[model samples]
Each structure stands twice: as C-alpha cells, then as structure tokens.
Target: MGAVSAPPLFSRDFVDDPYPAYAWLREHAPVHKTRLPNGVEAYLVTRYDDVRSVLADPRLSKNAATSFPGWRPGRTGIPGEHRSGIAAHLLNLDPPDHTRLRRLVSKAFTPRRVADFEPRVIETADRLLDAFGPEPVDLIRAYAFPLPVIVICEMLGVPPEDQPIFHEWANGMADRSGPRGGVGRSVKRVRGYLKELIHKKRLTLPADPVNDDLLSALIRASDHGEHLTEDEAAAMAFILLFAGFETTVNLIGNGTLALLTHPEQLAKLQADAGLLDAAVEELLRFDGPVEFGTWRFTTEPITVGGAAIPAGEPVLAVLAAADRDPARFTDPDTLDLSRNEGGNLALGHGIHFCLGAPLARLEGRVAFERLFARFPDLALAVAPDELRWHSGLIMRGLHELPVRTSSPIRADYQAH
Candidate 1:
C-alpha cells in the first residue's frame, strides 16, 4: 500500500500533541516533505539516526543567503533580520565567519563565567518564586519567562529601568505567528538600541575598566584583535539574548509541567537531590523546547533515511520526534530520571550544537531545584488536557502553566 498522507502537519492539534503524528512519520515517511504554514516547502527528517546525521551534514548549509535560494522576504529567517542589520550573526553564516564569531564570543561565555553566574541564577529564581501566593498563578508569566529574561538582561548589561522595555521587544520579536509588521518594528528597535549602547560603551572604555558584562566584553574584543564589526557585534548580542533566554524559558516551563504530570518522576527527583541534573536531561530529551532543528539547505543531493533530497532544498530535522525514537532509546516513551543514554538531539548535535547549552543547563538545574524545594506540595491548577501550547513549529512551550501550592504557610515560613 502507498504511504499514508502525512497526518495534518503543524496544525493546532499537532502543536498540542505532535508525538503521535511524529511516530507515524517515523514509521512511514522518515523524510517526509511538507509545506509549512508560511508556504515554505521542506523535508522533515524524522528518526534518531537520520536527525543526528542531518544536523551535522556538511552538504546541508545553514547560511541562508547561499542555501535558501527560495527565501521569502520577512517570512524566511528571523523577521526583519536583514533590514535591521543584525543578520550577520552565527546562525545565519557559515565557515570562517561562523568560526571567527563563535570563537570570539565563546571567550567571554566560558564555563567559569557561567559557574560564577550561578549565584545570580539562584537569586533570580528565588526572587521570582517569592512573589507567588498559595493561589494559582501562571508560572510562565511569574517565573519561567521572567527568570531567564532577568538573567540574560543582567548578563548583557541592560539597566534595570530598560529591562521592561527589553522584555517587551523580546516578546514582540519572538512571536513567530504575530504580524510581520510588529516583528519588524521590534527587530529595528532592538538594533537601534544596541547600536547606541555599543557607541556609549566605546566612549567609557577607558574610564570604565571594571565593566564586566558580556556586551562590554564584545566591545573590548572588537577594540582589540577580534576585528568584529559593529553590525556583527550587535547581531551576536541579539542572538545571545534571544537564544539564551528563549530555550531556558521552555526548559523550565516544559520540564516543570512534565514533572507535575508524571508524579512518579517528580517523587523520584524529590527523593534524590542528585537526580536534578539527570532529570533536566530527561526532561530535555522527553520534550525539549526546540521542536525542530533550524533550517538547513542542501548544497548537494543527499539521502536521509533512504529518501532523496535534492540540492538547494531546505531540510529540517525533527528534534522532538528524533529524541523520542523508540529504536534509539529503550522504552522511549517512559520518563526515567536515572536512565542515561547518549546523543539526544534535544540540545542538538554536531558543529551547530547550541552555543548556550552550558548556561541553559545551569538555569534549568537551578530553576527546578529552587522551585521544588520551595513548593513541595505544588500541584497543577488546570487539568493537564486543558493546557494550551503555543502554535509554532519551532518552539514547544505552554501558553501558561497555572500552578498552586497545596499547603498553608505561616508568615514566618521561609523558602529553603
């Protein structure tokens, strides 16, 4: 019999529960070609092995200019990236340019730097959770969203007064389904702000020798031998902010929801504090924030999962589906916190693996540890089935996570 027509791909229902469709695709059409809502046609690579291979394939290029010959204005790539002059960052480039930019930024975003920032992450998490009452509250708004926003803001040296403004623009820029005009405006505004901020930092470079923020580091790098252009600097900072916070938001939100739904897993995590790290990994593998790998265009004809993809066509590895492939994982559907397996595409694989993985892990580990420690009796306010997920192909996150503490606390009660 012929292959079954790909189950209604990327619809609202699929957004809410894509696993079943993904399973079907994995079994039947591992390299299924489908048109996205924006009218861009591409091949969706399913299966763990295929997804992993596709992510690292040299023949598949990430450079939008060279690879995406069918690019649609405002519809393809980040909205307004070209017009805002922030399109030259790592994600949109390849080769020597990608290498140079990533190396320069990595010098500042070191493991020691992330470790030093742990106290701040814990402080931010605790502060956000402190405001919660026994009554139901949307975790996304009160906790998940703002925690990372504040962390990234502080790291980027955005002043306290400007944080709200930054958050507004981030929200606007992140809305994948919002009006194109709104996204463009947000991108332009952020670009303008970054340009001005960079200029101001240059003037103070001599007087402000103690400045230690990531933005300051970038400016100094450019002033030194790094040779980074202003546009490149702004673009790198822009991607770092968006990439740093956006995934962590979902990591906390989705991971929390996963534990809340799977009481056994939650109990296991509660029983052993050592499991926090492993639990985060499991949560990421089970339902990571990134649903699909970023777009890659074929530089030459390639066969993925036995399906031939011609040169110049765009391909997306279904990270969500690949992570759940039964063949690659033992009892893949089961959420085992102690279960250890390698090569989950949740954080991605190969050269383009997420640059912010270390920071994301730190935030997720701290967020969950602080949250559960504070609210041991936490329970979902809404039925699990009633929860709504944002309708986007790239990000997998809840619209809101209404949760409440079941126990009454005295005025003197303090979070540990």
Candidate 2:
C-alpha cells in the first residue's frame, strides 16, 4: 500500500476544527514538516513532551534575523522601518537581550500588580454586561474585544477614545491576506502613535505621585539611562498594545463558546462558583487563544520525536495540539472542567512564557464568572456549522461568536 499523504496544514478544514488533525499529527508525525501559509517550509512539534522541549530548548533561536538571515521583517508585507521598531520586543529576542527586556517589563506586570486590577476588571465586566441587553449579540464584538482593550488601555494610560484606532491597526496586522500593504500601513500608524505618546510623557513630570501605568514605568526606565533605549521603549509599548488585548479577547471569546457548547459544564460552573479557577484553566486547555508559539528557528540540527529538523529552519510549537494530545491527556477530545491534569501550554512555557498570563488569567476568571452569572441561559445564535474561524496561521479563534443571551439552552448542544 502507498503511504498516506499528510493533511493540508493551512486548509479551511484545519482552521474550522484543528483538534482532529492535531491528533493525527501527534500519532503519526509528531515532528512534522509543513509549508506555512506564506509558503515558507517549517517544522511543527505536536506531541506534548516534544512541544514542551522545543519551547524550553535554548538551542532554538527566537531572533529570526540571526538564524534566518534571508527572511524579511514582516509576514504581511509590513515595511522594514516599521517592522523592526515593533518586532524587537521581548517575544522576538533570545538570552541576555530577552532577559533584560523581560526583567524591565516584568516589574510592571507582576502578580500583585495584576491582582490590583481585579476590581477594575470586574467593574469593566459589569459595565460591558450592563451595556449588553438581553438579546442575541456578537459576544466577540460587544464584550470579548472591548473588556480587555479597556483594561490594557487604562493600564497603559492610553486615552479611552483612541481604542478604536488601536482596534483598526490590530485588525490590519492580524489580516493574513497582506492586503495591498495594509499591514505595513498599520504598523507605521501604531509605531508613530507610540513614539508620540512616549514623547509627550517625557515632556511632563507629575509631582507628588508618579503615573502608575505601564507606559510611564517603561518611560521612567528609559529616562533612568540604565535599562531601555527610546526605540526599545517604543517597541515594548507596541508589543504590549498588540499582544496584550489580542490574546485575552480570544480567551474570553473561545472560553465562552466552549461553555455555551457544553451546557452541562456551564451549569456545573454556575452551580459551584468556586470552580472558576479550575474552569478557566480547563477552558484554556480545551481551546486557548494562541494556536502556536511565536517563531523559533533551529540554531543547529535537532531531532525532535525521532524527526530530524535541519539547522536554520523555523519551528513552531503547536500549543493547541499539545494541550489536546491523547498521550498526555485522558480522553483529550472531551472538555471536562473538573479534570485536574495540569501543565497545559495554553500561555506557553519556559523563558518565553507569556508575560501577560497573570492578567489573562484574572480577566478570564472574571469574564467567565460574571458572564455566566449575568446570563445563565446563554447559547449559540447560529448553527455550529455556520460559525467561522479566523484564517490566521497563529491564532485559533472564531471570527465572531454570535450568541443569544436570552434564549433557553438548546437540546442538541453535544452534537456540535
């Protein structure tokens, strides 16, 4: 018999529901080589242990400039000038540079700092829910998108009115089509805005008390002359603005959809509010925001799960796949909130573990708790087959979760 061909990596089928394909990869080709959406050849690590190992391996380089010299700055045709300023943030660095950048930003996003924002997050959730009347609404548009944007903006001291602009820029960056230099234009606009904001902050010094937002903290670090440069500071702000809200938005959106589909779990969660933390973790495990870890290039030839990946090749740790690997999790396909098997790579692992994890967790806990409490009868507005997933290679999120807040739970929930 002939060998079976590998499934298409970036097909519409893969996007709509990736778990099945992920399962196939884990069982057959744990270390699979595939073509990226942009037609670049890359290796994918799918098994749980292999994915974790690849993520923490120091031999793998995050800075594509050093490893993949021929590679250009942006995937969506972003301009060179605009790309470097934003791409030089913590996620794109390795070793000493990554360490230095992370340490400076870590201070502003410590667990305690994120804890202090809980009340504000809850308040924001309340306001969002209050604004959402008892009717069918696109939760992605009405709640999931705005709550995190507001929280992150307020923490960064960004003017509330400028949020729509950020949203526009983010949307453009996320577009996979690379539509006529749209990504480059968005990058330029956001970079320009951050530069101007930093300049204004530098010109003014508040007496008695300092600004507590992250941007001010970053600015102070740059001014102190010991840590960050002006360009680095701008890059840090750009990363925070871009990565900060995008993940949480998908988390809330995806988590809510999970609960709505699994009415029994939702009921269990609503009945026992104490399960909020565990429930959030399960939601993250079941379907997290980030589909894959950021770019990592093989500094040297490495064997992962019996597959040899050559040096200088880009590697992606498929988080969604690893989390759902049957070898790792019992009945991996099922979404059981009560399951206590930990070590899900939803937020990633190692030195590059998500800096905003604490914030995302806090937001997720609050969002799920309040959302369920507010509308116990929430459900999907359209048939499950009718819903569409985002086409982006890195993000696994529904384009819009049209949900009926007031409708009674459907009888055929499990069929989805």
Candidate 3:
C-alpha cells in the first residue's frame, strides 16, 4: 500500500476535528511526513504502538541544540537569547540533563505530595464556583483557568496577587498563531519574573529548606551543589508555571466539555462519585489536554510503522491521535467512563512522562466533583458546534467554555 495523502497536519480542519484525518493516517500512513505550521518538514507518529515507541526512543533526541544545522526544533518563536533560559527546561533536554532536572522537582509532584493538595484544590474549586452568578459564565475564565493557576501558584510559593501577570505571560507564550515578537516578549517577561522571584526566595530562605515549597527546594538545590545552575532553576520554574497550569487548564476545560456533550457518561459519573478516577482517565484518553508530545529530532535514521524517517528531521507523537487509535481501544470514539484498557498516552509515556500528571488528575477529580455537586444541572450555554478550540499544534484546549449554573445561590455564599 502507498502512503496516504492528507491535509496539512496543522490545518484548521485538522485542529477542529482531527480524528478522521488521524484515523486515515493511522491506517494508511502511520509514520507520515507533514509540514509544521512554521513550514518545517517533519514526520508524525500517529499509531498507538509507534507513538509509544517513539516517545521512549533515545535516538529521537529532545535537545534541538544537537540537531543538524539549519533544522530548528518547533518553538513558540521565542528568540534564541531569551529562549536559552526557559528552553533549559526538562522538556527540551535529553537523558542525563533531563534525568537530573526531572529528579529535582519530582518529589514535590509525587502521588502523596499531590494528594496533599486535595483540601486546597477543593477549596479553590468551590470558591471559584461560589463566585459564579446564576447567569451564563465562561467556565474557562471563571473556573478551569484560575483553579489550577492558583493551586500551582500556591504550591510554588508564587504570590496569589501576581497570578494575573502569570496568566498574561502564559497566554502570550501559548499563542502559537501570534506574531514572533509578541511570543518572544512574553517569554522574556516570564523569564525575567522567574529570575527575580527565585532571587527573592533565596534571600529569605527558610531555616529548613526541606520544609519549604518546590521553588525554595529548587533554590536550595542550586545553592548547595552543582545539581542546578541559576539559569536551569529559573527555566524549571518558568516551565512549571506555564506548562503545569496550562495543561491542567485544558484537561479541566476539555474534560468538562466532553462530559457536557455526553450526558450519559456525565450522569453515570454524577450518580456514582466513586467512578471519578476511572472517568478522569477515560476523559483524558478520549480527548485529553496535549495534542502532541514536544518536538523531537531524529539523531539517526529511524523507521516507524514501516516508514523510514531520515536523521535530523523533526518528529512528533500525536498523543491525541494515538489515544483514539481503533487498534488500541475498543470503540475508541465512545466515551466509556469505566474504560480500563490502560496505557493511554494522554500524559505521555516513558522517562519524560508529565511530572504534573498526579496534580492534573487531582485537579480534574476535584474540579468535576465540585462542579457537578454544586450545580447538578450544569450545562453548556451555547450549541456544541459554537465552541472554539485553541489553534495550536501542541495543546488541545477550548478558548472558552461558556456554561450556565442552573441553580442560583444566596448572595452571602459569595463571601468565601
């Protein structure tokens, strides 16, 4: 059989409803060549097995610095000078460096550690919901976006007052369709803010660093030994601030939208709250936050799903596509709350798996539990087709999720 020809991978049609095209690629061109929105030639690994394999393959290097000259990795258009700091994040590093960077903050995000945030997560969710009036509200702005941002901010010791600043910076960086200058400026602002924040935290280092938050711990790590450089520390903070909340924001937004559209599953979850865990997993598998894994470059010629990709070419594992692969899940399109097939790549696979997965899950569970419990008749304010999704190749999130809280609460309830 010959390779399947499809629309540009980053086309609006593909962004709006990529499943049909993904299905075609999976069956006919699993290891397909396509152009990124920036006009960079790349190969997309679309099938479940291949995507899982490519994610863990050492030959597919994450460090674009090692790629052949003239082949730049996919970026948000941040300039090289400003990029060096934030780009030092774990997502852009290969083994050793990647391993080192991940280990520094991994303990803070452990299952037990993340579970510790349950009380705060619930409080934040409820507080946000309480503030919502009876009328229709953009759930993305009112709840999904702020909840995770606040939680992550609290966890990292970022001032609650500065959340608006972080949100502005993050939005600019995440806008892949925006001008390069704008994205570059956002990156610079965030990097500068992190540097100042880290410096301030270091000056006030608590008596026992171990008792401090993730940022303080990172500062201690850099202060004590060669574990992390100043640049790397700031980069780590920037990535955590942006990547941490951004993905969860989408998970909550996308997952909630999914439940709203699938009333049966929503009803099932609302009835038996115990199914929250499985439901969150199924929702992630069905249509999770990340659309594709971060950019990777082939260090050597590699063949995936029968297609040979040359060395130095960029590669991406379409997690959104792989999770819905018919070969992997039964009735892949159906939203099954009890789905136990497991191994969904929504949070990704292998060593570079999302460090924030535990937090994301906790947030999702808390968000859904509080959301449905507070407003049993929660629903979309507009038609399903009227919703707009973010136009980015890496992240899959709704721009705004307008929803109506059917029941009105007393005005005093808003005093939280």
> What clash count goes with each model?
0, 0, 0
lDDT of 2 by residue, 22-117 (tens): 887887788888888777778888999999999999999988878875577664222443354667788778988898888887765678878988
| TM-score of every model versus the real structure | 0.96, 0.92, 0.93
**Model 3: residues with Cα > 4 Å off, grouped in runs:** 1-4, 72-84, 175-180, 206-211, 222-225, 410-416
Badly placed stretches (over 4 Å) of model 1 are 176-180, 222-224, 408-416
Candidate 1 local lDDT, 254-320, one digit each (tens): 9999999999999999999999888889999999999999878999898888888899898989999
What lDDT does model 3 reach?
0.81
- Candidate 3 lDDT over 61-168, as tens digits, reads 877777744454334223442344567788878888787778776644457767777898888898898888878999988899889888877887778789788877
C-alpha RMSD of candidate 2: 4.6
Error of 3 at 195 (Å): 1.1
lDDT of 2 at 168: 78
